[model samples]
Target: MQDTTDFEVWIEDNEPDGYEEIYTLYRSVAEREDNGIWAVTTNGDKTFVTGPTSTLQLLSEKARRTFLNAVEALKSDPEMDMESWYGYERNMANSKA
Candidate 1:
């Protein structure tokens, strides 16, 4: 079985698709007991499952770039007051709602 570290790298690189594929590769290491939790790290870090595993495979490189940019923005502005990142996302969600 591949480790979590390797799987993380794989996802960042290949971005495999299909629930069965993801489950096969990541289920043992990443599956969470909680209903809302999709994957949890050994260190207890958590990331929500944004969509179906197949959706992840279909994500465009441009979308990945945008996501990385957002992560960079959040990291560069760790002080919440410096950048209301969560607020921006909340507003975006509200607007969509």
Candidate 2:
């Protein structure tokens, strides 16, 4: 293992065609079954990694840079929040309802 001390997990946002932010997460405290959590990022946002630690440890650098945006908006953001950020408002289908 590279001992990233953190991992980024890719998440599919609002189906059809969407992706959530990437995140650089680290091993947090025990949750209960010893399945701690990915609780750390450079941007100050905290969220659950939503997958197994084994998967995270195996993530590639590009994957981490792409998915780790959830917590901390890393420098890799070439657009600088111009078009990178997406939210529920974009899901016009549900909004119309």
Number of the top TM-score candidate: 1
3-81, model 1: which lDDT tens digit per residue? 3323244365445343333333333223322222133323224332332231122134344344434333333235543
Flag regions of model 1 displaced more than 4 Å: 7-10, 13-35, 41-83
Question: What TM-score do all the candidates reach, one by one?
Answer: 0.26, 0.23
The lDDT per prediction is: 0.35, 0.31
Name the 10 consecutive residues with the lowest summed lDDT in model 1: 49-58
Tens-digit lDDT string for candidate 2 (1-97): 1233243323222111222222123112111112223333222222223433322332344444444343334334445452333333244336574
Candidate 2 to truth, TM: 0.23
Best by lDDT: 1
- Worst 10-residue lDDT window for candidate 2 reads 26-35
